[model samples]
Target: MLDRVITISREFGSGGRELGMKLSEKLEIPFYDKELISLTAQETNMSVTEFLNYYESIPVTEQSLEPPLYTSFSPLYEIPISDQVFLAQSRVIKSLAEKGPCIIVGRCADRVLEDSINLFIYAGIEHRIERIISLNKDLDPQLVENKIRETDRKRKDYYQYYTGCEWGKAQNYHLCLDSGLAGVEGCYQAVLSYLGHCI
Candidate 1:
């Protein structure tokens, strides 16, 4: 049996990816984040750009289990592009979990992998904005804030559309950490400590 799998879902500007990478290194396990996009593209024989476009988008038809009051139609709708991408990625995630322990970041791995430790990482908007500004010092603060809001909105929509659950809801995850409060290193240590006790 696979010993342990950790899935992290994060707010757009949160340090979840950094924490995940650090935790993976500390635990000596493989890590999947942007790497998942490449793997899924290879598996589906689709271009990376195509996968990136539909990476976390949901089909309009799947906006709700029940029909919506109004529906917008698109050529891609017929192809179910988002569904195809998600299914391909889902297969890859399951395969990786079955192979052994690993850390998966984003792409809804928490929903794809059974018996995995699911963590939701979030930070206050002010903290997120500050982090983004620090990383991209040349960018305007307003632009950075707008970008963060848009990315987080897309992530939330994609996760909810696919999983039928609200993103960042504490109830949906095994643990919820405020990366803003703990910082990346502190959060990594906390996750390690939790894993040590649980697994």
Candidate 2:
């Protein structure tokens, strides 16, 4: 079922966003990544920077802070900024999905929109380190690896927190590709092949 939507959930430095744009072009569909942040900002009258920081993250509760016993009763203001941003982004994602087919990267679009083709891109740690260095020269390899793991952990926690599904689990996605093994060109071809079979 080509639902006219593709959601890419990926580990940091996995080239997932790049693959999303590439697929978007080949499929002649709109691609949304950072554009989602800007759109959410406009819809919520919030700053793009705010969404950038909190969109996919679960807010940290202070020491001794208690979890809400009755979340439905709490006013929106009582909600954490992270939750607010997620709600705004979810609204934007669903609205966009309704308009037409598109490729949405990150921001938990896979979980937010039902029946969309979900793909998760990931690579080995060493491969990710090299990829990260290729894009950003002059970074220390050790630090780059650290950051990559950190970001992936954050994403995993955030996804699980919101969706109760483990991140990067094969069962949670329609397709899981190791971009490190299959270069972008190869991954792109695989996606086309998958879609061809689906149709």
TM-score for each model: 0.88, 0.89
lDDT: which candidate is best?
A: 2
The residue pairs found clashing in candidate 1 are: none
Runs off by more than 4 Å, candidate 2: 1-3, 50-53, 62-74
Q: How many clashes in each candidate?
A: 0, 0
lDDT of each prediction vs. the true structure?
A: 0.81, 0.83
* 1-199 per-residue lDDT for model 1 (tens digits): 2378999999988898898888788788899998988999998788887778877777765443532211223432454767777777888998899888999999888977779999889999898989988888898888888998999998998887777778988988988888788887777878777777784
Model 1 weakest 10-residue run by lDDT:
67-76
Clashes of 2: 0
TM-score of 1: 0.88
RMSD in Å for all candidates: 4.7, 3.0
lDDT of 2 by residue, 1-199 (tens): 3557999999899899899999988888899998887888887677777656766678797731333321233466777777777777787889899999999999888988887999999999999999989988999999998999899999988787777778988999998999899877788889989998875
